[model samples]
Structures are given as structure tokens and as C-alpha cells.
Target: MGEKHRSRWVETLVLLVRNPMAVASSLVLLVLVIVGVFGDVLAPYGYNEQFVGDQLESPSGSHWFGTDDFGRDVFSRVLLGAEVSLRVGAVAVGISLVAGVLIGLLAGYYGRWIDDALMRFMDMLFAFPALLMAIAVLAILGRGETNAMVAIGIVYTPIFARVTRASVLTVREEVFIRASRASGAGDFRIIFRHVLPNAAPPIIVQTTISLAFAILSEAALSFIGLGTQPPDPSWGRMLSEGRGFIEQAWWMALFPGLAIFVTVLAFNVLGDALRDVLDPRQRSALSGKGAAR
Candidate 1:
């Protein structure tokens, strides 16, 4: 089993590195992480520092991106915005992943009344539009970055729950699971030790995709004054601020918007690559096709 797992991971790594899209996306994501971590060091000016004479200045040597309406460096703000976006996405996804996986495990393992009830509740949540549901939660919780994270987490929970439940249901009927049950293994042991590991691929893929959407959701919330507030540089808020002066100062909207677009695209592409790489059926099919080739 250990050898099998090792070989499986090896195959996945091989496939991932060999894929051009995956490699490129990984590099982009890597750069995003680097920027998020060292933004302060890399940025010439503070994110909120107001330049006396540079308000609405176009991209130039001192400010590669440009200056915003407040004379603050657009490059600095965009650099730091990566941290805000990534932090929100990570926390939001963490919240959903934990809650959703637990709910899914419980629902799948103890299918019947529990499954029906849990699934129905998730369905109710899923029925609402993702952004609308998030907005409603924010309305109730009041406005702020923390609240936005909570709202986004809540909105995405149903999706993760549904994905995890389907994966668990598929794993539940496997020969090894039945064998483990027959051997008097506890439910917790079987579920955690065997079931969850086997069911993780789809969940991981879902997580990556969820992160992309989470970033977008955070940006949208910030755009509407529901997320990262004043003095705190946010790409969404930057966009909101830039739209008014778009005619005269288009760089304000363009740079931050491009950041959001590129980051989301990277995550989505990585998710697609992981999905293709992680599936055993897909891996076998690829091998067969290669042999035929």
C-alpha cells in the first residue's frame, strides 16, 4: 500500500510537471505567493503613502504602475493587495473545507436520516446565488473583511459539502471499505484512515477552484465596501476608486483588475490540471493512450 501510494504520487508529479499549462500556472501562483510575502520589501513606497506631486500620475520610472487619486503608489497597493486577497481566500476556503468535509463525512458514513437532513440543508444553502448568499450573510453579520471572509466561507460551504459527499459515497462501497468493516474496525478509523484519503482528489481539486472564486468574491465584496476597508489597500476597493476617474486615470482600474484576472486564471488552470492528474481512471487512460502512441 505504501509503495502503491508512492508510485501514484510519482505519477501525479510527473504528469503535473510535464503539462505546460500546469507548469505555467504554478509559476504564476508561485510569484503571487512571493509578492504576497515580500511585498513591503519589493515595493518602493508604502501602500498608503501619499505622494505630494504624483496624484494620478501615469506609469513611469518611480511608479511603474502609476499613482492613484490620493497620490499613493498603485504598484505598492497592488503589491500589498495580493496579501489581502490571498489571506481572505485561504481563510475562507479553510473555513468551508473543514466544515464541509466534516459534514460530508458524517452524512456519507451514516447515510439515512442524517444524510437526508444534511443534504437537504446543504441544498437549501446551494439554492441561493453564491454572491447573493454572501451578501445576505454580510448584511446580517455587518460589514468588514472578517465578515466578508465568513460570508464567502458560508456561501462556498455547500459546494464543498456536495463534492465531498459525492466522493465519500463513491468510496463507501469499495471492497477495502467493506473488508475493513468486516474486520471490526471502528467507523472513525475506517472513515479517516481509508475513506477520506481515497476521496481526497476531487476535494483537493474543488478546493483549488474554490480559492479562485473566493478571491473574486472577496474583490467583489471589497468593491462594494463590505470587505477590507480604508487605509487597507484592496484590489476591489482600488477598482471602485478608479472607476470614477477611469476617463482621466485609467491605470487605477487597469493594473488591479489585471492582477485579479491573472491570479484567478492561474488558480483555475491549476485546478483543471490537478483534476486531470489526480484521477486514477484518467491516469490509466493516459498510460494506455501513450502505449498506443
Candidate 2:
């Protein structure tokens, strides 16, 4: 029994690890996340500390990625900026996921008026452009990274709710779910133990994909001056500041923009790969392989 359980878990791990795209993306994301978590230690200079003599220096042996207009080390600032981007993205996605999952569970399990009402509410949110809704929320909440996160979270919640609701609707009717009900499983036990666990794979994939969008939204908000204030280095804000002097100092914008591009692309690719790996069909195939072996 122990060996079989361990073998099943290993097979699942193998399935996830076997996809080259997923593996690569996951590795890249891991690096970025580590950098974000430990940027202060990894960065050569403080994000806010200015180097008076090194303003706007191009990439060189000493400066690496070079210096910005404020004489801060561009490389260090970008590293620290990664922390901000990831923090915002992770926090926003987490909040949205929790809210979405709960609302979806209620809508899916209850059905009838509850389903219709919840879905219509979600549709209303879906109708509003994410950027527009986020902008409005930020405007009302005032300019700050935390507030921006709240805005992004609210903007993305509807998508998660919709996905979760659909997944739950399908899963609720499954034969195993019916058997659980017949076995006298309490509603809460059935949901927590069986329904949510089975429903989580696609939701997990969606959340990973949403991380990219969340980061992008944070960048957009910061670029518009509604995010991370002065002295707090932010990639989006850095790009905004670099726009005017792009021709004269290309490194100012290039490095930060590249960081954003690579990170977002990594998450998106990873999400797609995870979807394939965790697919129920793939899971069944891997189980068959395990049994055969």
C-alpha cells in the first residue's frame, strides 16, 4: 500500500517533469522568484541608494547593466523590482483564487437561483475591462502597491469564479461524487475532500496564468504613476521614466522591460505546460503506465 501510494505520487511528479516547456518555464520562474525573495542580499546596492557620479552610465565592466537617471544601479534596482512585481502578482492571484473558489463552490453546489445570481454577477464583472476596472479601483483606493494589488485581485476574481463554477458543475455530477453522496458524506466533507481537490488542477493552472496578467497589470498601473511611489524602484515606473530618454540611454528601459517580458512569458508557458501535465486524461494515462510497470 505504501509503495503503491508513493509510486502514484512519483508518477504524477514524473508527468509534470517530463514536459520540456513546463520544466524550462518552471526553472526560469523559480530563478526569478528566488531573486525576488532575496533581492536585497543579491543586489549590489540598495534600490533607493543613489550613486552620484554614475548617473546614466551605459553597460560596462563595473556597472553591468549600467546606471539610471537618478544614479541608482540599474541592475540592483531591477532585481529589487522583481520582488515588487512578484509580490503584487502572488498576492493578487491568491486573493482572487480564494474569493473565486468559495463563490464558485456555493454557486455550483447549490445551483438554481444561487447559480444564476452568482453567474450573472460574475458576468457583469467580466463585461468590464480588467484594466479599466483596476484603474477605477486604484483611483478610489489611492496610489499604493497594496491598493494596486487589491485592484488587480478584484479584477481577476471573476475569471477564476467562472472557471471554478464550470469545473464544479461538471465534477458535481460525476459518478464518484454521486457515490460519495450515497455513502452519507456530509456536504462540507464531500466538498473539501473530494470536490475541491478534484476541481483544483485546472484552477491551479489558471492561477499560474493569472500571475502573468497580474504582474502586467501592476506594471501598467505603476507606469501610469498609480503604483510604487518615488524612491521605491519598480520596473513599470522605471520604464515610464526611461521613455523620454530612450534614445540617449537605452539601458535604462531595456533591462527592466526585458525582466518583465521574460518573467511574464515564463509564467504563461509554465501554465500551459501544467495544464497538459495535470489533465485528467494525462493522469489516467500515467496511472495506466504505472500499473503496467
Candidate 1, clashing residue pairs?
none
Task: Name the lDDT value of residue 265 in candidate 1.
Answer: 99
User: In angstroms, how far off is 251's CA in candidate 2?
Assistant: 0.6
Count of clashes, each model: 0, 0
lDDT of 1 at 166: 92
* Total residue pair clashes for candidate 2: 0
RMSD of each predicted structure: 1.2, 2.5
**Total backbone clashes of candidate 1, pairs 3 or more residues apart or in separate chains:** 0
Provide TM-scores for the models: 0.97, 0.93
* Candidate 2 worst ten-residue window by lDDT: 1-10
Question: Per-residue CA lDDT of candidate 1, range 1-293, in tens?
Answer: 66887888888888888789999999999999999999999888898899987899999998999899889999999999999999999999999999999999999888999999999999999999999999999999999999999999999999989998999999999999999999999999999999999889999999999999999999999999999998898999999999999999999999999999999999999999999888888877766765676
> The CA-based lDDT of model 2 is what?
0.89
lDDT of each: 0.93, 0.89
